[model samples]
Target: MAGTGICCASLEEPIALMKMGLSMVLIGHVNFLLGALVHGVVLRHINLHKQARAMEYAISNVVALTSGLVGIVVGILAIVLSKNKKSKGLTWSLFTVSLTAALMAAASAIGLSVITNECPFDPTRIYSTTLILWVPLIVTCVIQMVFSARCFAVCISFLGLPCCPNRKRTRPYGRAINVVRPLKGSRPISQY
Candidate 1:
């Protein structure tokens, strides 16, 4: 958790998060493409015995694709707005979108894993082909989830957004004293 926070905080550096945002867009496109491929190709050829499972998988794929699309949009926004340090509200909105997309990706991955595990591997290994295709989809979804979560952490920890309260100062008393240097030949001032 601390590691994640550190990583996310590092991304706030000028071009780092912008690069991260670009990568997020790439990952989102990959997820979207994989979801579409699985839905359009693999699902259509599923065996009747596993139709129910396939349907569930298909639904999860749809969720993945939807989340991917959302991720892409948010990523683009992040890239564009990264330069504006004071847009806390916008940053908060990005964090919210990222959090939601992360949740959806996680749920979709879980559903996919459950449905995949439920299906048995027969001698013919018909399902293996589907699994082969789906492995990338699962990997992409998890990857996107991680990316989104990272973005969430960055927004929360680094962005001193108005929505979240700032950390309290450790010392509430006097401010730091500015020390004055005596002239080269002058005697130091005496303190009581």
Candidate 2:
């Protein structure tokens, strides 16, 4: 809170961070739910380099590893900010992490698509593995992007700016003057 510019002066600061946590939970569930798709791959065969599937496997590994690492950072930040009594601009940090994850997943999807299309994957011809995680991973990624965006939108709508003009706004030393004119017959104009 010292160097950080975010002022946790209000109560609504962590709402965005909470949404980001939900997004993280969803991503983790997707990974855990689809673990079977990658269980059959042997460790020693990854660097064989003699097979065309190596590149595809490498891309998958990178994507998974990157997501996991990024997720750790996001989780730490979100938890710290949410738990802290004073936190400001937590949404910005969560937004950056989520944006990075979304972009990384998108790039991985493109690479994986090329590999899937170019390669003739047949269990008989090649030791092809089932890519069942593809759909879940993609769907989770899209949902994460949406959730991340939503966190930002919520932060903005709740705390960023006034949605509409506020009339009765008060300052430190002066009273809020919402009513420009006094009510008729109710009280004197000077009293208002």
Misplaced by over 4 Å in model 2 are 1-19, 32-48, 83-92, 120-129, 152-192
RMSD of each: 5.3, 9.1
User: Between which residue pairs do clashes occur in model 1?
Assistant: none
Residue pairs that clash (backbone atoms under 3 angstroms), model 2:
none
Query: What is candidate 2's CA lDDT for residue 21?
Result: 61
Tens-digit lDDT track of model 2 for 1-192: 234322232223565455456456656456434433453443234453666666665666467546645654555555565666244566566657756765665554455445444443333313444455555555554554444444434434434446633333545478666866656778886675
lDDT of 1 by residue, 1-192 (tens): 244532455666657678778888998999898888777766666664755645676678789899889879768867876787568777888888989989999988887777545663352555766677678888988988888887886787557656644454356566998999987978778842
Top-TM-score candidate index = 1
Q: C-alpha displacement of 173 in model 1, angstroms?
A: 9.5
Candidate lDDT (C-alpha), each: 0.76, 0.51
lDDT of 1 at 187: 75
